[model samples]
Target: MILYYALLIIDPSLIGIFINPFIVQFTIFTRVYFIACLLGVLIPGILFAIRSIKSDKPEINLQGKLLLIAFISFTIGALLTSSIPQMTIKVIARLILVTSSLEFYMGYLLPNWVKKILLKNDN
Candidate 1:
């Protein structure tokens, strides 16, 4: 994967073509990369989140849920950004990407304020 990405960085035209100044059509290599990411990262992440959610600890469960949301939102955002041509839809996708980043941060760190608010709701 690293080699493939490196090659792409060195010569983007080897796998991709610019539709216009702003848009690049998806290529076979790009599709393969997306598939690799989905299988390698997203699927495993979702599985881990599910396992965590099933744990006995409330904190773990909350973290799992947040992580799950983050993963799902990130996927949605990426797909929307790549597939849609409209600028407006792209903006919405970027917002979802930002939300996913925030969710991932909260899940990984579980800050005191977030923990208090989330745990308070459970009680």
Candidate 2:
């Protein structure tokens, strides 16, 4: 499921009315991009949660807080951008920033940890 979503869309235009935040803009080969993007956004959360689970010391309240901040910032920014296209773009860019940063840091700095959990107990 994560892999499928990662290969979804490149420049996802999640700004439509009825389809807003509901539909994914994708292409043929773009599935990989969307999958990557999805992984970028979620892999961090999964890994963090797993590590805590393994250590028996769950403590990622900060992730939820940061995620909440990101959501609030994106929502407010997009709402304000109702009158400006550039501002809307800025809001989307910020959303991308939040996820991409999480992905890169986790995938890079904590590669071993992610691999260990991702490969763990998959029967």
Candidate 3:
């Protein structure tokens, strides 16, 4: 991942940039990066989440659900932002991306307040 970012920094055009609302272009590098993300990040995350969800512990199940939502939302947001040219769609996609971060944090950290709310329902 570090090496990939380094290459991106060396050549910014590898990912291509939006010049206008109606114009969108993606370079081969961008496709490769997308595929790398899917394989390296999303797939592992989903597998972990599923395993966690299958555990008997309620806390683990909640965490797994949160992680699953986070990964799915992140993928959707990334896909929308990359493919869609409209400004409104971009804004919505950014919001989804932000929510995914929050979900991931909650899943990883399992804050006490969130645990109380979510796990309480199991009783």
Top candidate when judged by lDDT against the true structure:
3
List the candidates' TM-scores in order.
0.82, 0.26, 0.80
List model 2 lDDT by residue over 1-123, tens digit each.
Answer: 544444334333322232355333334444445445455655665555445445432223333444444444433443333423454565775566666556445543455565465444444
Hey, what RMSD does candidate 1 come out at? Answer: 2.5
Error of 2 at 63 (Å): 7.8
Residue 101 lDDT in candidate 2: 59
Candidate models: Cα lDDT each: 0.85, 0.45, 0.86
Order of models, best lDDT first = 3, 1, 2
Q: Against the true structure, whose TM-score is highest?
A: 1
Show pairs that collide, candidate 1: none
In model 1, what lDDT does residue 12 have? 83
lDDT of 2: 0.45
Candidate 1 lDDT by residue in tens digits, 1-123: 786778789998866777876566777778677767766768988998999899898889999999999999998898887777777898899999999999999988899899988886643
User: lDDT tens string, model 3, 1-123?
Assistant: 675677669876666766875556777777777867766788999999999999999889999999999999999898888777788998999999999999999999999999887787634
For residue 43, model 3's alpha carbon misses the true position, in angstroms, by 0.7
